[model samples]
Target: MNSPDIKPPGAEPAVKTHDNRRRWWTLLAVSAAQLLVVLDGTIVNIALPSAQTALGMSDASRQWAITAYALALGGLLLIGGRVSSALGHRRTFIIGLVGFAASSALGGAAVNPGMLFGARALQGVFAAALAPAGLSLLTTTFTEPRERGRAFSVFAAVGAAGSALGLVAGGLLTEYTSWRWCLYINVPIALFAVGGTALVPADRPIRGGGRLDVAGALLSAAGFGAVVYAFNEAEPLGWGSPKVLALLVGGVLLLAAFAAVEVRAPSPLLPMRVLSHRARAGALVSITLMFVAMFGFYLFMSYYTQTVLGYSPVQAGLTLIINALAALLGSTLIAGRLHGRVPPAMLILPGLIAAAAGMLILTRLTPQTTDVLPLYLVPALVLTGLGLGCVLPPTAGLATSDVHPYDIGAASAAYNASQQLGAALGTALLNTIATSAAASHLASARHATPTGASVHGYTTALTVGFGILLAAACVTAPLILKQQRS
Candidate 1:
């Protein structure tokens, strides 16, 4: 990002310096927006304890802090895609940046849980716009294969490591200053992104774009929103509780209806063709599964380090840095370089396998494993980081690959929407699994200490995560390989 005049070595002779600068700036701005979304996912999590205490938030309301954002973003993403097409991607991106910054400011200045929740929801609304618009911008700008690969690598690496960076930032802010700074931090980042957007190439308008599909938008939003809220409520309410079941079933029906509407609509909220491509669909599924498993891993690591090891928030966050560093290596070094040459499955499948192996290593955890940093933690972090680093770039690229210019927004939205749903499901489902496992273990082994039971719960949940990762690999592997052969 620095020294705009200085190009990377081996700049193509055909490319002008001004063009190089614009493309790089575009990458920087889009990557920053992506980081904002991913970082916010976990940064606020670290600050939650402090925020809760200061706001007098009841334990009953804490989940809403997470749910409000996920629900809004997941539910509205499809509509956001349509909106991006209606309005220009560049315009939509700037609007999203301004709105997100304002919402972040409101969140920082919140006086009550209600205000905080509202602010979070507003942030999500803007993020739905920001994410798809940014990705589409990147896709349209970096048309060449090698340039696209490198640009995507940086973007993916930021996304892969952003959560850990959030942990680190949240810890430092919460410990050294007020927790409110965590939200306040977004203001400058957003403003910087907005400024950088000036260098971003404008999106050419889609010719003869059809009318907006109101029915599809409403159905998709309400459907996805309900599904996310259902999962969020599942841990406390019990999965089989009538409320959860009703919400889940209703959401599914609504989604089915949305799909049906898309089939007939003059202008669908998400064009069916966006997903009809087997590779793109598989990429979406893989992204969803990767996040579903990754978030749970993050949750347990944070808990185990802070609650069990009695580490400070900063120390806990610092422990995850290895994961981020390894991610950098894998993304830029391995996946980035090889991306243009190899099939996406080559990176994604092995990445999943490596992540599962890391989770398998963690299955050995016990409460008394006091010196886990050198033993259980580091290797697991490195493996998962490298794995995810390898996984994210290709999937992101695939999601937008071969997409029509008009449907790029839809494809991008689908990609990010998959990530949101995956994170929500992963956190809620895995936490529930961990809680239920701990309760069962305690009941079965009367002599087991609570700490031991907690560790057992974490390991059990991770074991499930391990299986999920492997299953995801299996599911997508054939899709990638078979399609390649055909």
Candidate 2:
């Protein structure tokens, strides 16, 4: 029979004593680690062209660099989380940080496409290890509601700002320095984080009877990898293509099989109980849906600003800083302050509505609209950032709240994985929708120029994005409201 506390074999034992004074420093270390991971997600985008040119890679082959990172990191996230529980948080964190830094160094020094791709994938593996461990550390460290909210607010603000910061940093480095610096930049950050790890409380590894569910880990990782790869390929190859269809189908089948295995296994890579709570489940779903809008928005906005508005990479990056700043204020000042005082649903619902309205504002954009920055883009970006800021921090806290200590790592992994998969799905599905809309506009319109068709497609996609945000609100608002009432 399982004990109430269930110190399963892979679960780490609780620390005997915590250094209360050093907790804030620990948060800084974990936050820095998380910032590095999140920043890497978008930092490579601006540098991709330069990297490709340096490595002499074809356009078709170039995506492998990005895809490799996503697949490895996203797919292995659960395993990494589980491993964190098994190995202890500080150990996992340090190992992950070191490995990640080394991989970044390797990527920075790459002389060929293969070397860069390999290094990118390796970076992903270490990222998988780093993210959940950091989050779980934060979850375990800050248990008081007020302090937790404050902590998550800081973490969420950093996360919200990281992608935009990545754009600016990438642009600066690519233009003024070298693309290699983008990867090399991670090394110093990682080293600093490693040193910061010394302040963290030591965790004792859980040693007991349960064995690792190797099969469950394999199935889940492969399933997720295939799904991410399918979505990625869907952009280049039509959704109906055989390769895409097979991968999607196979991925689903593998995931289903993994579910069956988890039900019967003594120890699971992703314990079903971690997702059993209504709040946690709702949080995960909302996080996924939010990213669906966010990832698509970033991709299309980059295209619209650069292709239509004729912004330079640096200028394009600079414009996004508005969104980042807005997000920081909204998350840390607005949402963070209101966390315990207000019901989460109240904040999230209005935020979602505001975000939808913001996306709707984006629909007014066109090639004829010359004052794009002031008239349409800035307002929309600010609104979206505000909305997201309200949503992310609170929901992130909810994601791990009330979770079992044994399952904390898995819960964190699930949250991060949802964001990753959501981004991949958004990028693939929305891009496809927009491309098809453009093609149809070209074919059907009476006086359709390429520019007009493209803009029309972008607006059409933005409309869909608005609809998605509304749908997410519909799904999440009721769940949160119901929780509040109960």
Candidate 3:
């Protein structure tokens, strides 16, 4: 029989001497790593137009720039998570940062579209490694409940604000400098983070005794990759295309297989225990829904600003500052205060409702309308930000709260995987819906005018986006509230 005092097969050993100062420094390093990962998603978005022009990319290939990163990051996230458990978070984190910075430099200097896409994929691969490792590091670093709460609050705030910050930073870099700067920016950040990591103490190293869930990893990655690819192709190809149908079917089968593998494996890639708690499951669902609305909003708003409102890259970036600022304020003040006092569900419900309302308001924007005319959107943006701030902290807190210390890496992996999948699905689905709506509107436009068709399409897309957010709210409300009541 196993010794009762012995650590689990793959668990990290506890630190001999816990130093609070060193831990905080470690948190900074981890936070910096996370910011780099999240920021890459939107930062490149702001540079898409410039990259296209510079590389002379065809319209057909433009989406690949974004899709490549999402597919790689989303596909490999579970693998990254398991790797953290099999290896150690510190080793994985440093490795990821180094790889990501190198990839960023490659993308920045690329002269062709293919090279750029390759670099983006490389970046995603490393991001998948870095993101989960960062979260896992946070989970292990703060063992005390009070300290954990404070640590998560800061982490959640950064997650909420990172995208908007990316937009502003991307805009500034792309406008004043070159689009290459967007990719190049990670170099310095990663270097600074690496330096901090050196000063921070490493977690108790894992003994190499357990095997990787290779079968599970392949199935989950491929399954998710296929689903995302199907959605992406659905826009360019009709829904009935055989390729899309086959991929969709294959993806479903693979995911089912992954579930089967998890059940029988000696050490599951995703342990069932990580998701045993009602509050944790509810939090994951809430986060997924929130991203559905948030991702769609960003995609549409970026297009509207550039194509419809005639804003330059810099102006487009500045417009998002309002949302970022509000997110920072809300997360810092409201989210932190509400934790442990009110049920997390109570905070999540109103937040989802507010976001849905904001999306509803945005649906009314027209091509001819000035940004000032839709000033109502500012408050709505704040509402969306506020809602996100409330949901993220408590949800993150709850998800990892009950996890076994040995499985903290897996828990972090699961959380980050859900987030990436949500973003991918949200972006793909919303883009498809918007594209379809645009085509339909164009076909039925007043005098077949380009501007008129574009306006009608954008409005229709926004309307559909609002409906999606409402549906997300409906799903989140019950699960979270039920858990809260129980």
Candidate 1: where is the Cα deviation over 4 Å? 1-15
Tell me how candidate 3 scores on lDDT: 0.80
Please give the clash total of every predicted structure, in order.
Answer: 0, 0, 0
Per-residue alpha-carbon lDDT of model 2 for 1-486, expressed as tens digits? Answer: 767996766445333234565678778999899889989999998999999999999998999989999999989999998988889878999999999999999999999999999999999999999999999889888887788888888898888889888988999999999999999999999999999998887886655517888999999999999999999999999799999999999999999999999999988888898877777777888889888888888878788878777889898888889988888888889889998888877777777888888899989877687777788998999998998888888888888888877888888999999999988998888888889999999999998888888898889888999999999888987777787688
Ten residues in sequence with the least summed lDDT for candidate 2:
10-19
Q: Report the Cα lDDT for residue 66, model 3.
A: 87
Could you say which candidate leads in TM-score?
Answer: 1
Candidate 3, RMSD to the unseen true structure = 5.4
**TM-scores, in order shown?**
0.95, 0.94, 0.89
Better of 2 and 3 by lDDT: 2
Report the CA-based lDDT of candidate 2 relative to the real structure: 0.88
